[model samples]
Target chain A: MIQLTDIQRDFQVGDQQVHALRDINLQVAAGEYISIMGPSGSGKSTLLNMIGLLDQPTAGHYQLDGQDVTTLSDEQQARTRREKIGFVFQFFHLVPRLTAAQNIALPLVLAGMSEKERNKKVTQALTQMGIADRAEHRPDQLSGGQRQRVAIARATVIGPAVLLADEPTGNLDSASGIEVVKILEQLNTNGLTLLVVTHDEALGKRARRRIHMKDGLIEHDTLQNHPSLANP
Target chain B: MKTRDATRFAFDALRGYRTRTLLMLLAMSIGVASVLVLTSLGEAARRYVTGEFASLGTNLIIVLPGKSETTGGGSPNLLGGTTRDLTLNDALAVSRSSLINHMAPLIIGSAPVSVRNLQRDVMVVGTTSSLLDVRQWHLGKGQFLPETDIDRASFVTVLGSTLKQELFGAKNALGEWVRIGDRRFRVVGIMAAQGRSFDIDVENVAFVPVASAQMLFNTQSLFRILLDTRSRESIPRAIEHIRRTLRERHQGEEDVTIITQDAVLATFDKILRALTLTVAGIAAISLAVAGILIMNVMLVAVSQRTTEIGLLKALGAPRRQIIRLIMTEAALLSSMGAGLGLLVGQIGSNLIGYFYPALPLGAPWWAFVAAIGVALGTGLLFSLLPARRAAQLDPVQALARR
Candidate 1:
């Protein structure tokens, strides 16, 4: 579950103040699949970063799983992020020097997981992402879709409750984009909470719950039954 | 994060960027190696000088004519005009002191000694038979000059091993009459090869009676009076006695300079030790330059890896973990460089010792410890700015960067 009330984010470019997010309020239940769509600079990404605990709100209240996370210390926030949230960036952000398997094992390593258990989980994630044969490949050595899959595996390998994907398929080709979306959908179907921020209308519409933003404010929030989810 | 994982992560990062790592290693290794090699060279010079002084006999003192003038004064009295000459009588008077053990009045000059068709220009040392005991020299053939009265000009000479070989060939040099500076003197002894004493080649000199040398050199003053004390502890008392005796014999004037053997050694030791530290300090500057290089390189690396740092932070690495990773990388590189420099320095010193066996060049244990400690310290210290920059980086901006 996630909650945000009167969340305001401001940026100072030079002399003038820029409002990136203004008076935003939202709430979502566990295991919900949601998409946040907007034009550039519409505060969609800023909202996702706030929810991911990567940025502090200029003025707001944020609660995650009944804890007021806005009041948490930096260390406690990091721990909460480690234990409860995962982020998949548009750039895939895979450490270029690490192999796909090592990339997926990073969160576990940060959590001080034993090598044996880390290797086991990494292998399972590599298999589940269907990048098992490409486990030894570096990010630069993989195709756009495979790299995104590795990034996704890295995000979800720690089995976090919420997954935040900011344009996960933004850099991929049409087929690869569809495949990544399907993998994300599969995870969501398995009861993982997924919040995707994207500019693609079709991808945004595929979510069960959708929110649209304009001028640093959410203009619409609605739930819809996607035909594919009904059939599967 | 686990230390093992942090270490491996740092190592892998360094390996991924080979040129940066190698450049840092090169700077650090050169710094450490130069410090070691330079200090060893200084150490060897000190050792060589100390060894030479040790060989020049202990508990000894020398009295020279003329006071050593340290200040610049054009006054005639301060010049050599009024300086009293150290003479045989002065040496005899000093010798009578109860604190004195043996005394040798020395007058040194260069003269050609001829034996039949063979002649070689040799340093002539003028002294009594006690010179042998005072210098701790051994006779390879017959006896040293016989001890006679201070006024007696005995026509006796001692041939150094080299001079005897050149003049007498394989024949017995003892009892041979050699012409030295237009005077024929019987050779009473052939000195054993004693290598070098101070700056003079001991094996190339010829020794004669003090009176005979005074006559040959046409001077009433002795060059120096060499004295041995009863024991090491008696040298101070003996020096005071000689000063009083010489002052009494020289119209109540203290014109002669009394130099205790330990004083000369101590002065040289202080000078050379300071010189060594100076050179070592100069070498240490190179280490500072190396540390600056590390700082510059690490600064560049943090910017280059901003995205990676952000990713690590996103994956829940704490600020300390990030610092640990960066610092560990720098620390590992410098320690490896230090290890390499130690090996190179040992090899370099050994090679120097092998070619020139006289200077036993070995870095003192403290040099090794200080070099390594300083290398690691500088490495960590200089990398701190970049590590802090990396740790404090905003994960959002960093991840947002390409």
Candidate 2:
């Protein structure tokens, strides 16, 4: 349900043009669980961001669910992102002032959903994330794992088609990281397309299909019949 | 996003940054309050001046001997101007106009008056008995000068309340004789206490018959002629008729200046109204300053909330929605500040009114509306740049910020 052809992203760092993503091509079907792994500056995060519609490719074509999304207007891109993409950032990015439920309800509010429906969806998200009791707490009041869970809930509350996680468990402890990964795996099992970008070898190995990158180019791509439970 | 939700979001943001919000509110409210209070003060001064002019009898006219320069011709005030003394006959001739209801020839001078052992220098006003009615000054005791011919030199005089008090403290002064400029005159009336009018202390002056004042001052020219028209409609006709008669009597030369009290009042009215507007404009500058303050604070707020803005954009909020959110916050702060300022200004005005009860210190309705409108307008206008900056923020760059 995702396609990229000759996608090239370049950044200008002072006087030189740095190619963040060079001649990237990828395709993935719906319900696929994939992990992109690389060292820093390998453009793995840039690829996920491109797939999430947060960044534009300098030279390329991107198709999402049969629509050529690379040609969409900024407004259309935002609409597509709203309707078909969800993102969980390493930093969580929860509005510090909003409570857990309110943070989850943000996408619904932006979609002009009625207050009643927004509250219902927020409550369901809280329950689905297993943080129903912490819905009233702000981001600062929550632990690292709980904050990540809230961020996940916010990402999925709108029922987007693809979930993009950039270092989902990067900041969590070992126990909480395992729990968060299990939750993401459970959602993937329920047929949600999940693409995770991480530098952790063990977490990357848990995916059904894995891609490794070095210097803005994919080094390897492999599909394992039986995913290894290297860490969990 | 729904407007209500946007507003609520903006409000929450403001509440989150309470100190910044409060400082902006204070600046805005102080600006509006100054506008209201300054305008009210200006309006009060205008009203006070207007009231003082209203105290001068309506339909009253004054005839001065020398014409003001603006009326044209050789300047009557200049030494070479064809200026002529206005005599009793000229006053008598002007009195013949059918439009003129009552006329009083006036002579003003300073002279030393003594009652036995007590002596003091005092202002002396000479006018006919009709001066009492024309000036609307009431007598505290005894009677005013009898109505007689204009040239009749009556020995009767009227003592102003203060002069009477100074000359004969606890004693009756109605029948007392006082020597004024070496002439003995009997006090026929004691004027009621009049503080001051047009900078002249009426309470310290003495009044005598016009003919007697002419004889005492050794001059035939009347200082001024005060006239009261039959009605408000008769004033223009009375002025025209007096000008014609005076011109005829003064060798057909229009040397006298005839000014209606309304014209003088209108001039003062126009000046005071302009003054009020000027002060109010000066006060509105403070509102612009407040607008700049809002812009600065909003810019800081946008920077501080960079991540939150990026998150909102990521959540699918449009650029216009982001702008609307910031604009709503600024508008809310402005309206609240304007409301609070109105309250404070009214309180300040009431306090001033309480202390100085004579001045009508009410702010005009337009001032109130303009103050609020300007506050809201400036607040919105100034916040536009910051709102636009917030809207233009790249979601990727913003989210990437620590």
Q: In order, what is each prediction's RMSD in angstroms?
A: 3.3, 2.4
Off by over 4 Å in 2: A229-231, B69-81, B114-120, B165-172
lDDT of 2 by residue, B281-314 (tens): 9989999899999889889999999999988888
Fraction of native Cα-Cα interface contacts (under 8 Å, chains A and B) also present in model 1: 0.59
Model 1's alpha-carbon lDDT is 0.89
iRMS, candidate 1, in Å: value is 0.8
Best by TM-score: 2
Point out where model 1 deviates above 4 Å. A14-16, A132-134, A230-232, B65-83, B96-99, B112-122, B138-143, B160-177, B188-194, B240-256
Cα lDDT, all candidates = 0.89, 0.89
Give one digit per residue, the lDDT tens place, for model 2 in A1-232: 9999999999999999999999999999999999999999999988998998888999999999999999988778878888789999888999998899989999988888999989999999899989999999999999999999999999999999899999999889988998899989988998899999998898999999999999999999999999987546
Q: Fnat of the models, one by one?
A: 0.59, 0.52
Could you give candidate 1's per-residue lDDT for residues B16-123 as a string of tens digits?
A: 999989988888999999999999999899989988887778988988987785445676484555977787888888899779999999899999999887889989
The DockQ-based CAPRI class assigned to model 2 is medium
Q: Find the 10 residues in a row with the least total lDDT in model 2 chain B.
A: B70-79
**CA shift of A122, model 2, Å:** 1.5
Compute the TM-score of each model's chain A versus the native chain A and list the values: 0.97, 0.98
| Clash number for candidate 2 | 0
